[model samples]
Target: MMKRLKSRLSSIVIAICLPVIVVADPIVGVWKTEPDRKSLISHIKITACGDKFCGRILSAYDASGKEVQTPNIGKKLFWDVVGEGGGKYGGGEFWVPLINVDAVPQMTLQGDKLLVKGCEHAICAHQTWSRL
Candidate 1:
């Protein structure tokens, strides 16, 4: 049980060191998403937006990791995620930029990575975003 204990200890330290508000909200930060079909990756900044969580594309990079200019930059990637505790969040709208559709989102936090998924009926997509 050392792993579990260590995990608890680390969480306790995080709770003690961070401000009450910051500790309560663990998703406030920049996250780098996995590369898309075109091998393009984007940095999403998650923040509190009107009592919910919203993510916007802060920047995008090409396959070679070179920053590129695009009109879609600064667009909203997702919004309206409500925290459900235990590292779970839901009730958000996630944008499918490729198909130009919006889908319901579900998210789970795992340490420094966030598993973000979007679903519409039987269709779904997910990405693992690393904290930046």
Candidate 2:
């Protein structure tokens, strides 16, 4: 009887702890793409649409910190962010129309940095993102 009671308690504990082991949506935040020292691409809002993730262009500014109106607003910067388990995400694509570029990136959340790498089999551009 004591062994059965202990087994039941262990089961209950495991059930309660399973969800704790899972992580929340870490990519749902703001991340800026560094274009250069004088300017950067501002992804004002990063959010999940169903199972996929996307980045929205809040605004774009040029050198010397000025908001320059561009044709990229309300565009989907990233898409198809899939969970690869262990708080890592991959198999996603980002579309930046201003530059006419579309690439696949592997995403990982480390502390406040949402590291996104655009890898096209031969080349890659790393974009480090901080939560706004």
Which candidate should be chosen as best, given lDDT against the real structure? 1
For each predicted model, how many residue pairs clash, with residues at least 3 apart or on different chains?
0, 0
Q: Looking at candidate 2, what is the lDDT of residue 53?
A: 67
lDDT (Cα, tens digit) per residue for candidate 2, span 1-132: 999999999999987765444324766767766664436556557776655666788887776667778777777777777768765887778764545687786888887887777766586677687776
| Candidate 2 overall lDDT versus native | 0.71
All candidates' lDDT scores? 0.89, 0.71
lDDT of 1 by residue, 4-34 (tens): 9999999998766655554359898999999
User: RMSD of model 1, in Å?
Assistant: 9.4
After superposition, candidate 1 runs with Cα above 4 Å error: 1-24
Model 2 lDDT-worst window of ten: 18-27
